[model samples]
Target: MTLTLVTGGTGHLGRDIVDRLVGDGHHVRLLARSPGARPDVEWAVGDLATGVGLSDALQDVDTVINAATYSPIARRGGVRPVDFFRSPSAVDVEGTERLLSLCQRQSIRHFLHVSIVGLDDATLPYARVKLAGERLVRASALSWSVVRAMPFYYLLDKMITSFAWLPLWPMPTTSFNPVDTSDVADHIVACAFDGIFGERTEIGGPQDISIAELGGQYRDARGLHRKILPVPMSEAKARGMGFVISRGARGRLTWADWLQHRYSVTHQAA
Candidate 1:
């Protein structure tokens, strides 16, 4: 039996990965900030940033699915790019470096990393750091598969909320194939089990929707009659957001489907 260790198993996508791997009968270990319990998950208290409690978590681990990240860029206000947890350089890049070093010593076979799509044309400080992290993983001796995912629908919710106080939603002209987090999780699980390494797979949603159109859909979904204002951006900046989908497992769920099903249900409950 293959023993798989999942970093950040407590996270949104991490938990789903844990369930998927365990359901497929893979022995799963979770690297968490503190010890926790689930039916099949073995918990190893560890810190990705500081490299503490790593050995205990990685002992005899065969494969690793690194899902850990520190992304606070959505509502970036008065934040310095390199200041502590506010930037991916501190948590994403450094933590991935620490985890990769551990995975190397443990002689881990496959390292499946979760990364965002626009890492190469990264305009944001976090995206650049994430790309840096990917470079490190690729440069390492461990066999690896990187899945570059699109902007999650949940992030769109934040984008809508941030403009809630304003009369008009100043939506970015940049487009995105906003995907369901679950779909991304499933793809990661597939990569983990398929034993395919040294491949970078990019996954995204069904249709490309500009931020303005997405905001319009969101406004309609939430019963908000707010005007959708398309905020024009520089071509260079639009290119940097990296929304164009080249290829991979396309998501079955659309933005409208997600809004009607997930967002509306959650928002109504709130």
Candidate 2:
């Protein structure tokens, strides 16, 4: 059995990747700061930001799927000027350089990286750091593949839910193609088994929907009759905000479908 190490294995996307890799008969090892009690796979208590336990995690590993990232802006609900300048580089950029250096030393066969879409022309600091990580993977000698994915549905969920208390919800009119994290996980696992192609694969959901439209859908899903206020953006900012992958592989579920599934499951559990 091939040994694979997954960074950020406890995160939203990382959890799905770990489950799929284990189901596919690969010996999965997860790198986490505070490891969970998942009995099926081995856990290495590590922090990518400080290069802690990464070498141990890479030992005897054939493949590495890097899903680790740090986004302070997202956690704070809005971007602050302080965080906007430097936040993601700690994990996504410098940590990647550290991980790649160790992977090279460990003679790892393949390195698979997960990144966001629209890094090419994005002005956002997070996207810029992700682009730097991509560059590092490309420059490395190890056989590698980078999977650039669209914004996930849950992110949109959080974005909309943040304004749940407001009578008039503010939403950007910028158009984007958001995908389900499950679909992105499937694509990543497929890339892992497809051998090291040393290419970038972009994946997204089916429709190109505006943020305001998506907010309306969220309102309908939650039975909230709040009015949506479209916030206008400058042409340059809009261009940076909106991204559509015309030729990339599309995911199965739409935003509405994801909403229904997520809420239904929550209702059932409740």
Best by lDDT: 2
Clash pairs, candidate 2, are none
With a 3 Å backbone cut-off (N, CA, C), the pairs that clash in candidate 1 are none
lDDT of 2 by residue, 1-270 (tens): 889999989988999999898888889999999879999999998999999898888889999999999877566555567854665588988999999999999899989999888778877777788889999998999889988899888877876667677889877787778999899999999998786567766899988888889888888778776889999766578656535443587899999998887776553210
Superposed model 2: Cα runs more than 4 Å off: 76-78, 81-83, 232-235, 265-270
lDDT tens per residue, model 1, 1-270: 778999878877788788888888889999988877676788888888888898888899888999888777444422343543336465578888888888888888889999888677766667778888989888988888888898778776765676576777777877768788888888898887786787667889988888788888887777766777789877677767665654677988899988898666655411
Error of 2 at 235 (Å): 5.1
Candidate with top TM-score is: 2
Candidate 2, RMSD to the unseen true structure: 2.6
Candidate 1: which stretches are off by over 4 Å? 74-88, 266-270
TM-score per model over all chains: 0.90, 0.92
The backbone clash count of each candidate, in order, is: 0, 0
lDDT of 2 at 41: 94
